[model samples]
Target: MRPGHDFIGVGVGAMVFDDDGRVFLARRGAAARNEAGLWEFPGGMVSFGETLAAAVVREFDEEYGMAVEVGALLGVSDHILPDEGQHWVSPSFAARWIGGTPAIREPGKCTAIGWFRVGALPEQLTQASRDTLTAYRKKGPA
Candidate 1:
């Protein structure tokens, strides 16, 4: 077993897609922790007492000022940024937009939020988020 491997964290993420197949992405702020200025789906760390779905819903509200109805589980991916000394196993979900428009509620963490067509996403997407989108495109809904 690897030393220091005992410590690890699990996170949950969301991929909110609209009726026209556009996906919501938010740009991180430059001064914020983790992938700052990079585009990614809205989500965050799962608290001790929250289920994955609940976590996503909470995160969506907190980050984008929106209410999302999370649907099926899309997939999960492991992200380890050795250079940043961060490791996480993130379970991502597919969310259906229910209400509220995207806004930069967490100004310190996020700067902007918008929907982009699946085929033409922003190039600054976080690697894990990109992987999630790729998988989503390949699977093309249930």
Candidate 2:
């Protein structure tokens, strides 16, 4: 049995900020597990025994070939996608860029990647990411 479809999945995300404070985002590809075609805070499913913080850090490195320093928790989101028949508990965090240039390491999962000012983000966003952003905004500082 597969995750998400067979059982609820757990994922981790990061609102990684660059030196200029722009947040990094990735557009989901057709093969994305859910919420394809929408933009989101780059993240992925967590492996067994993996801490959420470590998952977020690994996600950035694996998905974009970048490094990030994980910080305070943003919030936990109940990502229920009825249309896609998938559900996930997503915990997101605030992180800082450590180094490395962003690159799409998984073309099947991500179509485009970029840094955007928080004020001007892509119009279409995944629910999990939207929730994370809302939580982050409410959080303000560390």
Instruction: Choose the strongest candidate by TM-score.
Output: 2
TM-score of model 2 vs. true structure? 0.97
Error of 2 at 115 (Å): 0.5
RMSD of 2: 0.8
After superposition, candidate 2 runs with Cα above 4 Å error: none
- Among the numbered candidates, top lDDT falls to 2
lDDT (C-alpha) at residue 35 in model 2: 88
Tell me the lDDT of candidate 2: 0.92
- Tens digit of lDDT per residue, candidate 1, span 46-110? 88778999999998888777899998787787777687667777788888888987788878888
- In candidate 1, position 54 carries an lDDT of 96
Across 16-111, the per-residue lDDT of candidate 2 in tens digits comes to: 999898999999998889888999998899999999989988999998999899999999999999999998999999999999989998999999
TM-score on alpha carbons, each prediction: 0.89, 0.97
Would you give me the overall lDDT of model 1? 0.80
